[model samples]
Target: MSFTVLMYHEFRKRGDIDATSPSTISVEQQYQDALPKVLFSYIDDFKEQMMYLKTEGYHTLTLQEIKDFYEKGTQFPEKSVLLTIDDAFQSVYQYAYPILKELQFHAVSFVVLGWLSNEREYFDPSISKVMSKQELEEMLDVVELGNHTTHLHKRYPDGTSEMQATSLQELKKDLAECGEYVTYPDVFAYPFGIYAPKDIERLAETGIKYAFTTVPGVNTASTSVLELHRDTVTLGCTLENFKTIVEKGASK
Candidate 1:
């Protein structure tokens, strides 16, 4: 059996980003879209998507299951689905949480540990607040929290990503600092879906078993655990396209 891992960035009460919204800035923000307010799934659309999953016989699975299958040839659960929300935006707690709880569905979140510790903005000031430690603790029953590096989720002045540019030593240090939050059998989702070949080797050395990318596809035993792909649901995604994206995948 195979599975699909999905990536979500933020949640919005309104169904669409208005021209005046902070996230819909006139100036282009390519890097940040990869981080925080890059793409937003409104509460309504999210609800519809989850409802479809619930009624359509789709069930959630953990990244560990995919890792076990790829590394040990364990059989994946039938009709497995994995939902991952990147950056741990507060809206996940606010808008996405209740609906998921109501449906009794689980999701994995890749949180930036550094964003949680300091008083800082991840992107648009109005929408980038991250969840607190207490909030994270409270949601543990349904949310599988994973490490998304400590401080290297940011972008450099030359448009290079911190994850792509940081030294191995620095990356290790950041991962150690983030260890306070990450639990066992750690899984990582790349910042902006970006990674290099050495990044895979580095992840193995770091004891990270699963790392995900934003590439569109479902996971099979042959899928590279270090470079697993996921589909991002944008606000423009129609319900029909959403279903197609999940059942198969977005055709490249």
Candidate 2:
């Protein structure tokens, strides 16, 4: 069966959405010149999106169901979606978790295990911060953890990812280290939506069944699970545009 995978990163309150400084300017931009188009979404918008899914009878797929869809060729609901929040940001635990738990919707948070703190850090609404291990644990009810990488969420001076610059062995070690915290050992999201062909080819050796990219499209049975597509949901997206993106590429 086919489904849309919605990718999210940072979250902020609707009041924080300043017309002058958009939500698109994330903390990552200080280090990197370019960031993903879908970086952050308004917390209210996020809530509205989740409510829409609930009211519209959208089925949120579990990680196991997603694996079965590719491995066993199993069928899933036509209006199915997989919610993935990257970076395991504290905002997700503070905001998204409550909305999701209230709706009983399932989601996956791809975490950079090395970045996860042992205790809650100082809150700065201007910047998205990584969640503490305790906060992450509290989110287990509605969020399944996935691997983003251990400490490879960053890039080198030349913009080459640590994942890309390192040897395959190093990459495996990083993934394995992150896997220790991930709820699903077989699922990963590429850091900064960047990956080489070799990452896909060798990831299966590390027990990863699927690796999601930042590419936008609806994923079908014919799609490669290794480089599955995900539509980035950003603050710039209108609710109408969101509807279109979610339903885009589905078979009529």
Candidate 3:
């Protein structure tokens, strides 16, 4: 059967930025207030969502399982699914990790290398605090970490250039440095879910086997390693919406 991979970011409580909003400013505010309590609320919802998936006969798969099924022609259980989180938000450690451990589920995390040693607020201005090195190390014990990029770029008015090739290379170098700290898997998540065909080729050259995009779709046997689409789980997605995406499937 075809598989659906769900991509998530911060799971905050009442105050954290809602992933569903189109307006970046409002979302920024929400991200700033992402406290442990707020993060846990969404973790609760995520658990409930997983339970729903189980009832629907969906089997959660790791990225490697999906790869083996498609590339090596391995057999997968029915209703296979994969879970991934992009941008190493503190909430993943504070909230999501415990939930995954409880359910015995596995997930992949794409981390920004530059953000590792610095304070959280330095990387994503929306965050008030950052996860410390010790905290990140602890997280590594539970989840698979991948490259997100080094300096997460901002819009022109906000700071520097938009995501260009030069910026992409810089990000690549940042990821390489991050690899020194953590032995990330051969996977990547395009920052801001933004990428061009050239970017995909560039990533491939970096020894990345799988690069995930926020292109809002499902994966079939024919899907390519580059331009792999993901169904983003944001604030606007209700449990019903999540179900429809998983059941109906996604495409490029």
Candidate 4:
């Protein structure tokens, strides 16, 4: 059976319409309109989603578990799915963590090591709120922390790979240190869901077994671990959309 991996960002209660900037928007407008309402998703809403999935007999798997199941034919629960959160937003730790714990679901978090370490302070003031090292470490017991590079620049305006290789190299070193500090396996999640074919090869060299993308689709037995696809759950996605994505994934 195929497995669908759901990718999520901030789990806010209220929707933020202007949170993200478009490529065509001017820098000034980007600054002015970028700050959107932090939509708060009630804890109950989260529980309801999980309950619905469980009722439909969907099983959740961690990244490592997915690899093991495929490569080793390891026994996994029926109707399995994988849950992942990107960018290490504080709301993920604050709002999503408890609900996940209540549902007894395992999740993977992709964090930017530089943000957690406070090594670089320049960030979009609109979205500067990220989880710190201590906060992240505290939740390591429940969620798997993985690398999302130290600096998460998607690409240069010219579409050139900016700091991509260097960032991954530094991230490897930093994650090794973090593993010593937290004792978790070193995994990576590509930032902005953007990666070159070469980047995938480079990641494999770093011993990374799995990496996620923003691509919307289900994964099959033949899915490449380095280029794993994901279905993004955004503010605009309704419960129906979620179900449709899952159903379509199952069909694939």
lDDT scores for all predictions? 0.73, 0.80, 0.63, 0.63
- Model 3 TM-score is 0.76
- Winner by TM-score: 2
- Minimum summed lDDT over a 10-residue window in model 3 is located at 23-32
State which candidate, 1 or 3, has the greater lDDT: 1
Superposition error at 113 for model 2 (Å): 0.1
Q: Tell me the spans in candidate 3 whose CA falls farther than 4 Å from its real position.
A: 15-41, 55-57, 118-129, 152-163, 167-172, 182-185, 250-252
Candidate 2 vs candidate 3, TM-score winner: 2
lDDT of predicted model 2: 0.80
Candidate 1 lDDT over 72-165, as tens digits, reads 8887546668888887777787788889889999898887776663332233435456766666666777888887888788666675678878
Q: Give the TM-score of candidate 2.
A: 0.90
C-alpha TM-score for every candidate? 0.85, 0.90, 0.76, 0.77
Which pairs of residues have clashing backbones in candidate 3?
Answer: 12-38, 13-38, 13-39, 17-30, 17-31, 19-235, 20-235, 217-250, 218-250, 218-251
Order of all candidates by lDDT, from best down to worst?
2, 1, 4, 3
RMSD of each: 4.6, 3.0, 5.6, 5.5
